[model samples]
Target: MRPHTLALLLLLLATPAATRLASAACAGEKFPAGRAYAACEDLPKLGASLHWTYDAAKSSLSVAFVAAPAAAGGWVAWGLNPTGEGMAGAQALVALAGSGSGSAAPTVRTYNITGYVPLGNVSTPLDFPATDLAADAAAGGRIRVYGTLQLREGMRAVNQVWQVGASSTAGAPDKHAFQPDNLGAKSKLVLAGKSPAAASPSPAPAPHASGGGAASSKSPNAAAAAAGVAAPVALVLALVGFLATV
Candidate 1:
């Protein structure tokens, strides 16, 4: 066999192996949803607390994050929280899809993501099911997709990102032991518009009742007002009178 032909055959045989490895460390399970992998810290820091905002109106989850470039000890890949027991195959994908007519232009290399881990462990890396995007949705699954980035170091001896649905965050020696990796380019994440968790309802007052203060003594009606009620009985009487007439 010609040398080039042998090389081609070897590459072809390794394609599936390569693809499977991309999923994650096998734990007889799958990755998580609503999570992402990136090689940058700035991205995760952009959206402070409550990175996930639930849109009760649409009955959908909206994630807001800024795609930041990779820094030292940046995030490598993302997967289901190995700790997220029972539901691993759940996944999601959040990318900075820019305005483009087609896949012809040099697209923006944003700190987007592939899937998530049910349990939260952001120290190690996971898989990116580039092919299984729809499998989850078809199975009535959901994901909390976050924007992320990742780059491979081509090492597989220890600390392999083993994502076994809802199991331990371990992997083959090749994965369990991740070599020092780096991303040597500027990657940016823009703050895209986020959807409201509810009907964008007015900000409800924080649950800040202070030992039954003046605000607490107020009543639904002055008839039951406990002195702390502002504008007291007259206000209540008018409301009750209006209701009676109606």
Candidate 2:
């Protein structure tokens, strides 16, 4: 390859690595802009963690729960109780292990937790966009389950709980695994960002006529912005690398 061509190829190769580094840094901390959670709390007892982002502007709530790996393939369930205490009368999202060919994506079911015994029956799924759910292998022969829930509601908070099982027939017996037990500490849905009503309108700044040019690149905020701009390019390079390896 020509010297300049080789240099260009090397630059291209570095692009993906740079992008991955940036993404990894943001991993659990960031979600899709409007979809990201303001907090991620660990459920140590259940070997799981929860992340949530609330958009007060749109009255939307995005939730993601990751459970510890279950080698035999199991299930993870998250419940939201509008009334408070235990799992009774809570809306639940249960993710079960995929079967056979379609196993890459775990099947998700919505339920209404009724009765003191926590008998959850199939209920209406949320009207919001369908969530992305999957199970993947983790270190030490464990399987990790990841899922997201998007909800549109007026409530500011709700009591939450999570459960996991050793088999796919977990949660309700009609579903899979055995009965799922609560995993971690007390959980709830709390809004993070500013509410629409709390935000005050600010007048737009007048444009400067003098050609002072753009702000200094060395400025801390400017550097951060530049890094954000480069993120997309890095992601593209990472994709190219994966395709090349394939």
Candidate 3:
């Protein structure tokens, strides 16, 4: 076998493993009613994901946050913390599932996390302004919360917090679990319109919720995206093997 041919065959065999490792959680995620974003990340914790677009000139950010509740009839949430890296100062958007009949759409609300207690259905205005707050249920019992936020001029990054609760009381989010995954849910979010590589393993301060013990823990969308990658990889390997023999 020619050296060049062997190299080609090796490359082909290596392709699928490379593709799968590079696959991100949101690579093929679908939004309700065909919503889209320029960038996204499979957040490292809480089985949550974030899709977003940032307009630097206008200092505006639009985001779609996806996650499932801890149980049926539960709630999920996402928020940005301007003042610190934890939940105390976070400007949050919480989503509640619809009525048992499934007639109502999931509801989205904003909460100003002043401390570590249950919000009790209070819809507090965000410290930093947000608009178009909304939520909808998705396949696999996940819920998505969408919103646009106005940020200070030239802001480049901020702390982010997300959570899931087993239930809600009177439309407010109950406390999330205290497991390691839950506690690890908060991280620094780079406000860039780029790939997921820039978002993971946050370089900012280690996350710690000030008001309550904040933490959270993954998404199912990655499997769908990875499946799409397999077809092309198989074709490449087959073609390479045929060429090597010839």
Candidate 4:
């Protein structure tokens, strides 16, 4: 066999058996995005994250890339702002990497994210300079993502977060949508999937009370913990193919 062909064969067989095992663990599990989380092989390298909801403004979606970081990290979101084009969606390409510190920007074979399954038709394979993307609320919701890397062995994987919405149309997929930069902050992003449980006017802060004051019943530590889950996964992507550390 030729040199490149031989290398490819080794890569397929040499992948840590854990990868397949992890894929199996994720199989049929509901992604934070709502749909059945795909198998590990089918999942994005960043793990089964993609928890999303509309922003505090209710006009935009807020997507957190991961649930918690391996240690300390933040999430990203993609949302739409241009009310134009009837085109109201955006993309957030996050760099996931490492353990502990949990983030990195690599110089790997960069490819565009093609989101989830059926939507693959709409997803386009792309390349970039290790930057993240953010569209509108709807844009961040349900979608397919994948990338191709031109490394010594070449690489490809799909990372998806399915959309969630309140559409009653039969057989209609509830899409995750966002209005646009209605609001945002550093170390965070926005995109809301279909979450009926999600509060309108914005998801109520976890510590909030129905009457209008911080509730002693709710634990602030718990909310902070949930927030951290997002950080690790955000950083995971930076590990796999990042060319450099962030």
- Which candidate gets the maximum lDDT versus the true structure? 3
Off by over 4 Å in 4: 1-47, 56-58, 67-90, 98-246
Candidates 1 and 4 compared: the better one by lDDT is 4
Q: What C-alpha lDDT do the candidate models reach, one value each? A: 0.24, 0.48, 0.72, 0.27
Clash statistics: count for each candidate: 38, 11, 13, 69
Order of models, best lDDT first:
3, 2, 4, 1
lDDT winner between candidates 3 and 4 = 3
TM-score of 3: 0.75
Model 4: per-residue Cα lDDT over 89-113, one tens digit each: 2232432222243222311112233
Query: Candidate 1 vs candidate 4: which has greater TM-score?
Result: 4
TM-score of each: 0.20, 0.50, 0.75, 0.21
Which candidate leads in TM-score? 3
| Candidates' RMSD to native | 26.7, 14.6, 9.9, 21.1
Better of 2 and 3 by TM-score: 3
TM-score of 4: 0.21
Candidate 2: tens digits of C-alpha lDDT, residues 88-113: 66676666655566446555677666
- Residue 31 lDDT in model 4? 33
Report how far residue 83 has shifted in candidate 2, in Å.
0.9
Which candidate do you rate higher for TM-score, 1 or 3? 3
Report the Cα lDDT for candidate 4.
Answer: 0.27
lDDT of 3 by residue, 15-89 (tens): 644444454556567665434565577888878888776666677777789998999888999999988887888
* Model 3 regions lying over 4 Å from their true place: 1-22, 193-195, 198-246
- On the 0 to 100 scale, the lDDT of residue 151 in model 3 is 84
